[model samples]
Target: MTPRTPLAAAHAAPLDLGGRTALVTGAAGGIGRACALRLAAAGAKVRAVDRDREGLEALAGQTDGVEPYVLDLTDLDAAEAAAAGADVLVNNAGIQLVRPIEEFPPDVFHTVLTVMLEAPFRLIRGALPHMYEQGWGRIVNVSSVHGLRASAYKSAYVAAKHGLEGLSKTAALEGAPHGVTSNCVNPAYVRTPLVEKQIADQAATHGIPEERVVSEVLLRDSALKRLIEPAEVAEAVAYLCTAQASFMTGTSLSLDGGWTAH
Candidate 1:
């Protein structure tokens, strides 16, 4: 075989996150939980925040360096408070409500937006001063493929994700000179509890079988013909936190399995 590329050789070495403190929102389940676990395994002290107290505690119990915090992201003050003392912030909390725009409840719309967009912005704003003082920081916003494109029946989620992309870009610009970077990981459908629920709901609504929903409703939109894994997204987040990624900011790394290729 040909010799490995220089970049590939560098990537083969393990990332060192020792002594770093990271705050991961929505760390109770799915992608968030995976990210928290991966960070802890890489030697980071992680503050795992989520609305599910038991779930957060369970995750903390399993991970050596994880500290669980039960908090709602819709409350900006609480989110900001949870973010204090973190060198890295992973804004991964979000909700998805599937309904037509006309049928979508106003309260649900506001709640999703508040959690996905507003809370990430507030957390970044609150965390930046401390990061600036340290002259180093990383903000990883877990956006979605929906952020880059649109789909039917996901009005609120898509809108909130789109707005989050913009906010991350703005934050990246402001943090550039201070050795801080802000970037987003936009992934397509991942096989998570959230997606499982979506599959069930879609099955019920569309009068299709649960098995068919994954292939027909979810992956049908993607060119890769596969759903992404939570670990895949978590790996991308971890890569962005490294020293090599210092020059990267205000950009999105899409893990969409070619969903947006169309």
Candidate 2:
């Protein structure tokens, strides 16, 4: 992953999320964790939701304003229930598996759609009443370049993300009348445990060494050579929650390193 851009070091107006209750899924690590911390830094009381007990505990230890909520998103009802009364929602939990469509397991495909697509629907369902009632809310879906484009051997992930893109746009339309803004930040590959673990699998699937996977496979379509940092993704999420972005919804912010520019 590339180091934090020097441009970000320049001082700018600070985002203040004071008094807001932000809920971040998959908050145990990576982009989710960075978002939780960033929101906390901005004075929001962040509810860090994740299935990883140890990771959540660690996150709580590192931050003063975070409350860790441990729950599996697969339990859609529980997932929905957990989003109750949240002022800001970051839907960031996801799982990926790469294989030829013919060889992909049926059960895994269902799980992917369930976790990535259906769960977001339920979470939004649960969150909407509160958001609508308050006449203010933010929904940031952590989509990907895959959501807008296709790559072989990632049918389930691509399909789930594509469905999520549709869901996000629909929510934006419905949310418009209710003072809620829904949008997606579509980032390219990021440096996360999930992506790190996939390196070997990608190498194996593409018939390349692990060392070559980063340069040749991952960056093949990217104009920028380095993987995005989780904090960079978090910064984009933070910007959406600010008043400056109140008018921006039902759209996508691409952090794809020009992948979709083609």
Residue 35 Cα positional deviation in candidate 2, in Å, after optimal superposition: 0.7
lDDT of 2 by residue, 134-222 (tens): 99999999999999999999999999999999999999999999999999999999999989877888988989898899998888899
> Please, what is the TM-score per model?
0.93, 0.94
Model 2 is weakest, by summed lDDT over 10 consecutive residues, at 4-13
Report lDDT per candidate. Answer: 0.90, 0.93
TM-score of 2: 0.94
Report the C-alpha lDDT of model 1 over 88-190, residue by residue, as the tens digit.
Answer: 9999988887888888999999999999999998898889988999999999999999989998888999999999999999999999999999999999998
lDDT of 1: 0.90
Error of 1 at 207 (Å): 2.7
The most accurate candidate by TM-score is 2
